[model samples]
Target: MPDLQRTRDPERWDEEEPPTLTTDVTIEQPKTIITRNQSPDIAFDRSINAYRGCEHGCIYCFARPTHAYHGLSPGLDFETRLFAKPTAAALLRQELDRRGYTPAPIAMGTNTDPYQPIERQYRITRGILELLLETRHPATITTKNHLVTRDADLLSAMAALGLMVVNVSVTTLDRRWRAPWSRGPRRRASGWRRSACWPSAAYRSTSSSRRSSPHQRP
Candidate 1:
Protein backbone atom coordinates (compact mmCIF):
# COMPACT_ATOMS: atom_id res chain seq x y z
CA MET A 1 0.00 0.00 0.00
CA PRO A 2 1.11 3.60 -0.63
CA ASP A 3 1.91 5.98 2.16
CA LEU A 4 -1.23 6.62 4.23
CA GLN A 5 -1.52 10.27 3.29
CA ARG A 6 -0.88 9.67 -0.37
CA THR A 7 -3.59 7.01 -0.48
CA ARG A 8 -6.11 9.26 1.26
CA ASP A 9 -6.92 12.37 -0.69
CA PRO A 10 -7.61 15.42 1.47
CA GLU A 11 -10.35 16.73 -0.83
CA ARG A 12 -12.14 13.38 -0.71
CA TRP A 13 -13.03 14.10 2.93
CA ASP A 14 -15.61 16.64 1.66
CA GLU A 15 -16.86 14.26 -1.02
CA GLU A 16 -17.42 11.13 1.08
CA GLU A 17 -17.54 10.41 4.78
CA PRO A 18 -15.23 7.78 6.17
CA PRO A 19 -16.64 4.44 7.37
CA THR A 20 -17.28 3.63 11.06
CA LEU A 21 -16.73 0.49 13.11
CA THR A 22 -19.87 -1.20 14.46
CA THR A 23 -17.96 -3.57 16.72
CA ASP A 24 -14.53 -3.89 18.26
CA VAL A 25 -13.63 -7.08 16.41
CA THR A 26 -12.45 -7.08 12.84
CA ILE A 27 -11.85 -10.25 10.87
CA GLU A 28 -9.31 -9.56 8.12
CA GLN A 29 -8.74 -12.51 5.84
CA PRO A 30 -5.90 -11.37 3.63
CA LYS A 31 -4.93 -13.16 0.42
CA THR A 32 -1.20 -12.93 1.10
CA ILE A 33 0.87 -13.28 4.26
CA ILE A 34 4.02 -11.36 3.50
CA THR A 35 4.08 -7.74 2.43
CA ARG A 36 6.84 -6.64 0.07
CA ASN A 37 8.49 -3.29 0.53
CA GLN A 38 11.08 -1.49 -1.55
CA SER A 39 11.73 1.34 0.88
CA PRO A 40 15.33 2.47 1.15
CA ASP A 41 15.42 2.78 4.94
CA ILE A 42 13.97 -0.66 5.69
CA ALA A 43 16.28 -3.64 6.24
CA PHE A 44 14.00 -6.30 4.80
CA ASP A 45 12.04 -6.47 1.53
CA ARG A 46 9.20 -8.47 3.07
CA SER A 47 7.36 -8.54 6.42
CA ILE A 48 4.53 -10.45 8.09
CA ASN A 49 2.05 -9.00 10.54
CA ALA A 50 -0.08 -11.68 12.18
CA TYR A 51 -2.62 -9.22 13.35
CA ARG A 52 -3.94 -5.69 12.80
CA GLY A 53 -5.06 -2.97 15.25
CA CYS A 54 -2.82 -3.65 18.19
CA GLU A 55 -4.41 -4.09 21.61
CA HIS A 56 -1.41 -2.46 23.23
CA GLY A 57 -2.86 0.89 22.20
CA CYS A 58 0.34 2.87 22.05
CA ILE A 59 -0.81 6.39 21.22
CA TYR A 60 2.38 7.07 19.29
CA CYS A 61 1.94 3.97 17.15
CA PHE A 62 2.23 4.73 13.43
CA ALA A 63 0.06 1.66 12.79
CA ARG A 64 -2.89 3.23 14.57
CA PRO A 65 -4.18 4.98 11.48
CA THR A 66 -4.54 1.64 9.74
CA HIS A 67 -7.79 0.94 11.57
CA ALA A 68 -9.29 4.01 9.91
CA TYR A 69 -9.49 2.06 6.68
CA HIS A 70 -12.03 -0.18 8.45
CA GLY A 71 -13.98 2.86 9.56
CA LEU A 72 -12.54 2.67 13.06
CA SER A 73 -11.06 5.54 15.03
CA PRO A 74 -7.32 5.39 15.41
CA GLY A 75 -7.69 6.01 19.16
CA LEU A 76 -9.68 3.57 21.33
CA ASP A 77 -10.85 1.59 18.36
CA PHE A 78 -7.29 0.82 17.35
CA GLU A 79 -6.78 -0.83 20.73
CA THR A 80 -10.07 -2.58 21.52
CA ARG A 81 -10.81 -3.39 17.88
CA LEU A 82 -8.67 -6.18 16.48
CA PHE A 83 -8.15 -8.41 13.43
CA ALA A 84 -6.23 -11.63 13.01
CA LYS A 85 -5.07 -13.62 10.01
CA PRO A 86 -5.38 -17.16 11.33
CA THR A 87 -3.61 -18.79 8.43
CA ALA A 88 -0.53 -16.56 8.53
CA ALA A 89 1.90 -19.36 9.37
CA ALA A 90 0.41 -21.73 6.79
CA LEU A 91 0.50 -19.00 4.20
CA LEU A 92 4.13 -18.20 5.02
CA ARG A 93 5.13 -21.85 4.69
CA GLN A 94 3.41 -22.06 1.33
CA GLU A 95 5.25 -19.00 0.07
CA LEU A 96 8.58 -20.21 1.38
CA ASP A 97 8.11 -23.59 -0.27
CA ARG A 98 7.28 -22.02 -3.61
CA ARG A 99 9.58 -22.81 -6.52
CA GLY A 100 12.67 -20.62 -6.81
CA TYR A 101 12.19 -19.30 -3.30
CA THR A 102 15.16 -17.38 -2.01
CA PRO A 103 15.57 -17.27 1.73
CA ALA A 104 16.11 -13.75 3.01
CA PRO A 105 15.54 -12.59 6.58
CA ILE A 106 11.79 -12.17 7.18
CA ALA A 107 10.80 -9.33 9.50
CA MET A 108 7.89 -9.39 11.92
CA GLY A 109 6.41 -6.85 14.36
CA THR A 110 6.45 -4.24 11.63
CA ASN A 111 2.86 -3.05 11.20
CA THR A 112 1.68 -4.37 14.58
CA ASP A 113 3.21 -6.02 17.61
CA PRO A 114 3.19 -9.76 16.98
CA TYR A 115 3.71 -10.72 20.62
CA GLN A 116 0.91 -8.62 21.98
CA PRO A 117 -1.55 -9.87 24.64
CA ILE A 118 -3.64 -11.97 22.28
CA GLU A 119 -0.51 -13.79 21.20
CA ARG A 120 -0.47 -15.64 24.51
CA GLN A 121 -3.49 -17.63 23.40
CA TYR A 122 -3.49 -17.14 19.63
CA ARG A 123 0.14 -18.25 19.33
CA ILE A 124 0.34 -17.19 15.69
CA THR A 125 3.79 -15.66 16.09
CA ARG A 126 5.06 -18.79 17.81
CA GLY A 127 3.72 -20.96 15.01
CA ILE A 128 5.49 -18.78 12.48
CA LEU A 129 8.71 -19.01 14.47
CA GLU A 130 8.44 -22.78 14.59
CA LEU A 131 8.07 -22.93 10.83
CA LEU A 132 11.05 -20.64 10.41
CA LEU A 133 13.14 -22.90 12.58
CA GLU A 134 12.08 -25.99 10.67
CA THR A 135 13.01 -24.37 7.36
CA ARG A 136 16.23 -22.80 8.69
CA HIS A 137 14.97 -19.42 7.60
CA PRO A 138 16.41 -16.22 8.99
CA ALA A 139 13.82 -14.20 10.85
CA THR A 140 13.94 -10.96 12.83
CA ILE A 141 11.47 -9.43 15.24
CA THR A 142 11.04 -6.02 16.85
CA THR A 143 8.62 -5.83 19.75
CA LYS A 144 7.86 -3.89 22.96
CA ASN A 145 6.33 -6.75 24.94
CA HIS A 146 8.31 -9.02 27.24
CA LEU A 147 6.14 -11.86 26.03
CA VAL A 148 8.87 -12.53 23.49
CA THR A 149 10.65 -14.25 26.34
CA ARG A 150 8.07 -17.01 26.11
CA ASP A 151 9.83 -18.16 22.96
CA ALA A 152 13.31 -17.71 24.37
CA ASP A 153 14.20 -21.37 23.98
CA LEU A 154 13.43 -21.37 20.28
CA LEU A 155 15.19 -18.05 19.85
CA SER A 156 18.27 -19.31 21.65
CA ALA A 157 18.52 -22.30 19.34
CA MET A 158 18.01 -20.11 16.30
CA ALA A 159 20.72 -17.75 17.57
CA ALA A 160 23.19 -20.64 17.63
CA LEU A 161 22.59 -21.00 13.90
CA GLY A 162 22.73 -17.25 13.31
CA LEU A 163 19.16 -17.44 12.05
CA MET A 164 17.36 -15.10 14.41
CA VAL A 165 17.60 -11.73 16.15
CA VAL A 166 15.17 -9.77 18.30
CA ASN A 167 14.86 -6.11 19.17
CA VAL A 168 12.72 -5.19 22.17
CA SER A 169 11.44 -1.63 22.21
CA VAL A 170 11.57 0.51 25.35
CA THR A 171 9.56 3.59 24.55
CA THR A 172 9.87 5.05 28.05
CA LEU A 173 11.19 4.26 31.52
CA ASP A 174 8.38 6.09 33.23
CA ARG A 175 5.40 4.30 34.71
CA ARG A 176 3.22 7.26 33.83
CA TRP A 177 3.81 6.31 30.25
CA ARG A 178 1.71 3.17 30.80
CA ALA A 179 -1.97 3.89 30.36
CA PRO A 180 -4.80 3.36 27.91
CA TRP A 181 -3.02 5.54 25.42
CA SER A 182 0.22 3.53 25.54
CA ARG A 183 1.38 0.00 26.15
CA GLY A 184 3.52 -1.10 29.07
CA PRO A 185 6.71 0.98 29.46
CA ARG A 186 9.66 -0.06 31.57
CA ARG A 187 9.42 1.75 34.86
CA ARG A 188 12.90 0.77 35.97
CA ALA A 189 16.09 1.63 34.16
CA SER A 190 17.60 -1.68 35.26
CA GLY A 191 14.83 -3.46 33.40
CA TRP A 192 15.90 -1.68 30.26
CA ARG A 193 19.54 -2.51 31.03
CA ARG A 194 18.91 -6.25 31.04
CA SER A 195 17.27 -6.08 27.62
CA ALA A 196 20.43 -4.54 26.15
CA CYS A 197 22.21 -7.91 26.03
CA TRP A 198 19.58 -9.27 23.63
CA PRO A 199 20.80 -9.86 20.07
CA SER A 200 20.03 -6.25 19.11
CA ALA A 201 21.81 -3.73 21.35
CA ALA A 202 19.56 -0.69 20.93
CA TYR A 203 16.21 0.25 22.46
CA ARG A 204 13.51 2.31 20.85
CA SER A 205 12.69 5.83 22.10
CA THR A 206 12.26 6.08 25.88
CA SER A 207 9.90 8.94 25.29
CA SER A 208 7.13 9.80 22.90
CA SER A 209 7.96 11.98 19.92
CA ARG A 210 7.60 15.60 20.95
CA ARG A 211 6.19 16.67 17.61
CA SER A 212 3.01 14.61 17.61
CA SER A 213 0.04 15.37 19.82
CA PRO A 214 -2.23 12.71 21.33
CA HIS A 215 -5.26 12.03 19.14
CA GLN A 216 -7.91 11.96 21.84
CA ARG A 217 -11.56 12.46 21.09
CA PRO A 218 -13.39 15.64 22.09
Candidate 2:
Protein backbone atom coordinates (compact mmCIF):
# COMPACT_ATOMS: atom_id res chain seq x y z
CA MET A 1 0.00 0.00 0.00
CA PRO A 2 1.14 3.47 -0.75
CA ASP A 3 1.57 6.07 1.94
CA LEU A 4 -1.36 8.46 2.20
CA GLN A 5 -1.37 11.83 3.86
CA ARG A 6 -4.37 13.80 5.09
CA THR A 7 -4.18 17.16 6.80
CA ARG A 8 -6.70 19.53 8.31
CA ASP A 9 -6.24 23.10 9.45
CA PRO A 10 -7.29 23.55 13.06
CA GLU A 11 -8.08 27.19 12.46
CA ARG A 12 -10.84 26.31 10.00
CA TRP A 13 -12.41 23.73 12.30
CA ASP A 14 -15.08 26.14 13.38
CA GLU A 15 -15.68 27.66 9.97
CA GLU A 16 -16.45 24.37 8.26
CA GLU A 17 -18.30 21.31 9.41
CA PRO A 18 -16.33 18.11 9.47
CA PRO A 19 -17.42 15.39 7.14
CA THR A 20 -19.69 12.70 8.54
CA LEU A 21 -18.01 9.33 8.51
CA THR A 22 -19.77 6.10 9.39
CA THR A 23 -17.88 3.68 11.55
CA ASP A 24 -17.72 0.03 10.55
CA VAL A 25 -16.68 -2.73 12.92
CA THR A 26 -15.65 -6.26 12.11
CA ILE A 27 -15.16 -9.08 14.63
CA GLU A 28 -11.75 -10.76 14.42
CA GLN A 29 -10.92 -14.14 15.96
CA PRO A 30 -7.18 -14.41 16.31
CA LYS A 31 -5.15 -17.41 17.40
CA THR A 32 -3.55 -15.32 20.15
CA ILE A 33 -3.96 -12.05 21.97
CA ILE A 34 -0.77 -11.51 23.96
CA THR A 35 1.83 -9.89 21.73
CA ARG A 36 5.45 -10.33 22.74
CA ASN A 37 8.18 -7.91 21.79
CA GLN A 38 11.90 -7.76 22.51
CA SER A 39 12.49 -4.13 21.68
CA PRO A 40 15.02 -2.60 24.03
CA ASP A 41 13.27 0.77 23.81
CA ILE A 42 9.98 -0.29 25.35
CA ALA A 43 9.67 -1.19 29.04
CA PHE A 44 7.19 -4.07 28.68
CA ASP A 45 7.79 -7.23 26.66
CA ARG A 46 4.21 -8.34 26.22
CA SER A 47 0.92 -6.53 25.61
CA ILE A 48 -2.70 -6.94 24.57
CA ASN A 49 -4.73 -4.79 22.21
CA ALA A 50 -8.42 -5.77 22.36
CA TYR A 51 -9.29 -3.72 19.34
CA ARG A 52 -7.75 -2.61 16.04
CA GLY A 53 -8.21 0.96 14.76
CA CYS A 54 -9.38 3.82 16.94
CA GLU A 55 -12.47 6.00 16.85
CA HIS A 56 -10.78 8.92 18.56
CA GLY A 57 -9.32 9.89 15.15
CA CYS A 58 -6.22 11.56 16.50
CA ILE A 59 -4.38 12.92 13.46
CA TYR A 60 -1.00 12.43 15.09
CA CYS A 61 -1.65 8.85 16.22
CA PHE A 62 1.37 6.61 15.77
CA ALA A 63 -0.87 3.59 15.28
CA ARG A 64 -2.21 4.98 12.04
CA PRO A 65 0.78 3.67 10.13
CA THR A 66 -0.12 0.15 11.29
CA HIS A 67 -3.42 0.13 9.42
CA ALA A 68 -1.55 0.10 6.14
CA TYR A 69 -0.51 -3.47 6.84
CA HIS A 70 -4.14 -4.47 6.25
CA GLY A 71 -4.26 -2.55 2.96
CA LEU A 72 -6.30 0.15 4.65
CA SER A 73 -5.77 3.87 4.57
CA PRO A 74 -3.89 5.21 7.54
CA GLY A 75 -5.97 8.34 7.15
CA LEU A 76 -9.77 8.25 7.53
CA ASP A 77 -10.02 4.48 7.33
CA PHE A 78 -7.87 4.14 10.40
CA GLU A 79 -10.55 5.93 12.38
CA THR A 80 -13.81 5.02 10.64
CA ARG A 81 -13.04 1.34 10.09
CA LEU A 82 -12.23 -0.82 13.11
CA PHE A 83 -11.79 -4.42 14.17
CA ALA A 84 -12.63 -6.02 17.52
CA LYS A 85 -11.11 -9.17 18.91
CA PRO A 86 -14.04 -10.81 20.67
CA THR A 87 -11.89 -13.81 21.66
CA ALA A 88 -9.12 -11.73 23.20
CA ALA A 89 -9.80 -12.73 26.81
CA ALA A 90 -10.09 -16.43 25.95
CA LEU A 91 -6.83 -16.39 24.03
CA LEU A 92 -5.11 -14.59 26.89
CA ARG A 93 -6.37 -17.15 29.39
CA GLN A 94 -5.04 -19.96 27.24
CA GLU A 95 -1.60 -18.38 27.07
CA LEU A 96 -1.46 -17.63 30.79
CA ASP A 97 -2.38 -21.23 31.55
CA ARG A 98 0.43 -22.58 29.44
CA ARG A 99 3.17 -24.53 31.14
CA GLY A 100 6.04 -22.47 32.58
CA TYR A 101 4.32 -19.24 31.60
CA THR A 102 6.09 -16.73 33.80
CA PRO A 103 4.12 -13.69 34.75
CA ALA A 104 5.16 -10.22 33.57
CA PRO A 105 3.32 -6.96 33.28
CA ILE A 106 1.08 -7.00 30.21
CA ALA A 107 0.63 -3.61 28.65
CA MET A 108 -2.55 -2.19 27.15
CA GLY A 109 -3.04 0.86 24.95
CA THR A 110 0.50 0.60 23.76
CA ASN A 111 -0.57 0.58 20.14
CA THR A 112 -4.18 1.61 20.33
CA ASP A 113 -6.48 3.00 22.98
CA PRO A 114 -8.12 0.10 24.82
CA TYR A 115 -10.89 2.27 26.24
CA GLN A 116 -12.02 3.72 22.92
CA PRO A 117 -15.72 4.18 22.25
CA ILE A 118 -16.30 0.65 20.92
CA GLU A 119 -15.05 -0.71 24.24
CA ARG A 120 -18.26 0.48 25.87
CA GLN A 121 -20.31 -1.84 23.66
CA TYR A 122 -17.87 -4.74 23.13
CA ARG A 123 -16.44 -4.65 26.66
CA ILE A 124 -13.45 -6.68 25.53
CA THR A 125 -11.00 -4.51 27.46
CA ARG A 126 -13.11 -4.92 30.58
CA GLY A 127 -13.11 -8.68 30.12
CA ILE A 128 -9.32 -8.70 29.77
CA LEU A 129 -8.96 -6.68 32.98
CA GLU A 130 -11.29 -9.09 34.78
CA LEU A 131 -9.18 -12.05 33.71
CA LEU A 132 -5.93 -10.35 34.70
CA LEU A 133 -7.39 -9.61 38.12
CA GLU A 134 -8.58 -13.21 38.55
CA THR A 135 -5.16 -14.62 37.74
CA ARG A 136 -3.35 -12.00 39.82
CA HIS A 137 -1.28 -11.04 36.81
CA PRO A 138 0.46 -7.67 36.65
CA ALA A 139 -0.62 -5.25 33.92
CA THR A 140 -0.22 -1.63 32.88
CA ILE A 141 -2.55 0.59 30.89
CA THR A 142 -2.08 3.82 28.90
CA THR A 143 -4.98 5.72 27.46
CA LYS A 144 -6.27 9.22 26.70
CA ASN A 145 -9.91 8.32 27.09
CA HIS A 146 -11.80 8.66 30.36
CA LEU A 147 -13.78 5.48 29.72
CA VAL A 148 -11.19 3.47 31.61
CA THR A 149 -12.80 4.73 34.80
CA ARG A 150 -15.85 2.64 33.94
CA ASP A 151 -13.79 -0.40 34.91
CA ALA A 152 -12.56 1.24 38.09
CA ASP A 153 -13.90 -1.60 40.21
CA LEU A 154 -11.70 -4.15 38.48
CA LEU A 155 -8.69 -1.82 38.25
CA SER A 156 -8.96 -0.83 41.92
CA ALA A 157 -9.01 -4.47 42.94
CA MET A 158 -5.91 -5.17 40.91
CA ALA A 159 -4.13 -2.05 42.21
CA ALA A 160 -4.85 -2.97 45.81
CA LEU A 161 -2.97 -6.18 45.15
CA GLY A 162 -0.09 -4.30 43.51
CA LEU A 163 -0.93 -5.92 40.20
CA MET A 164 -1.78 -2.94 38.05
CA VAL A 165 -0.90 0.62 37.09
CA VAL A 166 -2.82 3.07 34.96
CA ASN A 167 -1.38 5.89 32.85
CA VAL A 168 -3.60 8.57 31.40
CA SER A 169 -2.07 10.34 28.40
CA VAL A 170 -2.78 14.02 28.18
CA THR A 171 -1.63 15.43 24.83
CA THR A 172 -2.61 19.05 25.24
CA LEU A 173 -4.36 21.01 27.94
CA ASP A 174 -5.68 23.68 25.63
CA ARG A 175 -9.36 23.23 24.91
CA ARG A 176 -8.75 24.76 21.49
CA TRP A 177 -6.49 21.86 20.57
CA ARG A 178 -8.58 19.07 22.05
CA ALA A 179 -11.13 18.66 19.25
CA PRO A 180 -8.78 19.35 16.33
CA TRP A 181 -5.95 17.28 17.70
CA SER A 182 -7.83 14.16 18.81
CA ARG A 183 -11.27 14.56 17.26
CA GLY A 184 -12.64 13.26 20.54
CA PRO A 185 -14.48 14.73 23.48
CA ARG A 186 -11.83 13.90 26.08
CA ARG A 187 -10.73 17.02 27.94
CA ARG A 188 -7.43 17.51 29.75
CA ALA A 189 -9.17 18.44 32.97
CA SER A 190 -11.43 15.42 32.72
CA GLY A 191 -8.45 13.11 32.27
CA TRP A 192 -6.76 14.47 35.40
CA ARG A 193 -9.97 14.41 37.43
CA ARG A 194 -10.76 10.85 36.46
CA SER A 195 -7.21 9.67 37.12
CA ALA A 196 -7.35 11.24 40.57
CA CYS A 197 -10.05 8.76 41.55
CA TRP A 198 -7.44 6.02 41.57
CA PRO A 199 -4.73 5.58 44.19
CA SER A 200 -1.75 7.85 43.61
CA ALA A 201 0.58 4.87 43.63
CA ALA A 202 -1.30 3.23 40.76
CA TYR A 203 -2.12 6.32 38.74
CA ARG A 204 0.17 8.36 36.48
CA SER A 205 -0.40 11.26 34.13
CA THR A 206 1.73 11.30 30.97
CA SER A 207 2.07 13.55 27.97
CA SER A 208 2.17 11.95 24.54
CA SER A 209 3.91 15.03 23.20
CA ARG A 210 6.85 16.84 24.69
CA ARG A 211 5.28 20.22 24.04
CA SER A 212 1.67 21.15 24.77
CA SER A 213 1.57 23.64 21.91
CA PRO A 214 -0.89 23.06 19.06
CA HIS A 215 1.97 23.32 16.57
CA GLN A 216 3.63 20.25 18.02
CA ARG A 217 2.56 16.99 16.38
CA PRO A 218 2.66 13.65 18.08
In order, candidate lDDTs are: 0.74, 0.79
Q: Quick one: RMSD of model 2?
A: 7.0
Off by over 4 Å in 1: 1-24, 179-198, 206-218
26: Cα error in model 1, Å: 3.9
Cα lDDT tens digits, model 2, 55-151, are: 8787768889999999999998888889999899999999999999999999999878998888989999999999999999999897777788788
Best by lDDT: 2
Which digits, one per residue and each the tens of the lDDT, describe model 1 over residues 2-74? 5565365686646432333243555567888989999999879999999988877776789888889989889
lDDT of 2 at 59: 74
**Backbone N/Cα/C clashes per model:** 2, 0
Off by over 4 Å in 2: 1-17, 179-188, 197-218
- Name the weakest run of 10 consecutive residues (lDDT summed) in model 1: 209-218
